[model samples]
Target: EKEVNSMIGRNPDFARRVAIDFSDNLASAKMLIPIPDDFPIMAGEILRVNTGLDIHLDANRRPVVALVGVSLMGVPIPNAWLGNMK
Candidate 1:
């Protein structure tokens, strides 16, 4: 079974309200968000959305996590696009 990090402060990119549901158990997950307000907007509209977060444990007693990392969000209005269109 895999488990998420309990130390919230350790990974500051996760949201405290977030929780990851794995098979039988639920693991605590947080997004250490750097720019909270802009995240939703910057992530592009055509980009893939993360359904959930998962943590993988290694045999060496190390933990690896996978998260939905996107560079863009939502489509800008036609008027807004015009502003950038030169």
Candidate 2:
């Protein structure tokens, strides 16, 4: 977590860009985030999207696991898994 915070501090522009991209994608209902090969797990943890795992087949017919439905900007939104359960 500390490392990721440091990285964010060092690369504010990249972080801001990512936040904007995440917001845009969310607004468009495109929730599948393409995990970068070099993305840090700690960073993902910081974003709080480290849970929702889904299996998808890649172009080579290989199974790939990825996180889905997790927020990017830490917005206070309802859980995507559980619909309005007032």
Candidate 3:
């Protein structure tokens, strides 16, 4: 996080335009966030997770998470997995 923060320090307008949604097509992470059995996991809900990142691009180019390996309960789902998830 320190590395990215450093870059933003010099530029004040960096935060003005966050093209977070632009990279929706390219998702480096596809995780299944844990939730209650009764609770529903919508596409929007999953992407809005506060798991620190957003999977966005500030300094790291093209989504920082490249690990296709799913982990414990894992991260929130990416846009590509919507059709696959029944």
Off by over 4 Å in 1: 1-20, 24-50, 68-86
Q: Tell me the number of clashing residue pairs for each predicted model.
A: 15, 0, 0
Q: What overall lDDT, based on C-alpha atoms, would model 1 receive against the true structure?
A: 0.39
lDDT (10s digit) by residue, model 2, range 1-86? 35544565577655543322223112212132445557766333334332244555779999775444444555545576546421
lDDT of each: 0.39, 0.44, 0.38
| lDDT head-to-head 1 vs 2, winner | 2
Top TM-score: which candidate number? 1
* Per-residue lDDT of model 3, residues 1-86, tens digit only: 34444554456564332222214534332223435556665433323222222244557475454333222344555646645432
lDDT per residue for candidate 1 within 1-86, as digits (tens), equals 23453553356554253444455222332223334444666443233222333456768978755442222233223433434332
Reference-based TM-score of each model: 0.25, 0.23, 0.23
What lDDT score is found at residue 86 in candidate 3? 21
Tell me the lDDT of candidate 2.
0.44
Error of 1 at 18 (Å): 6.5
Q: What ranking emerges by lDDT with the best candidate at the front?
A: 2, 1, 3
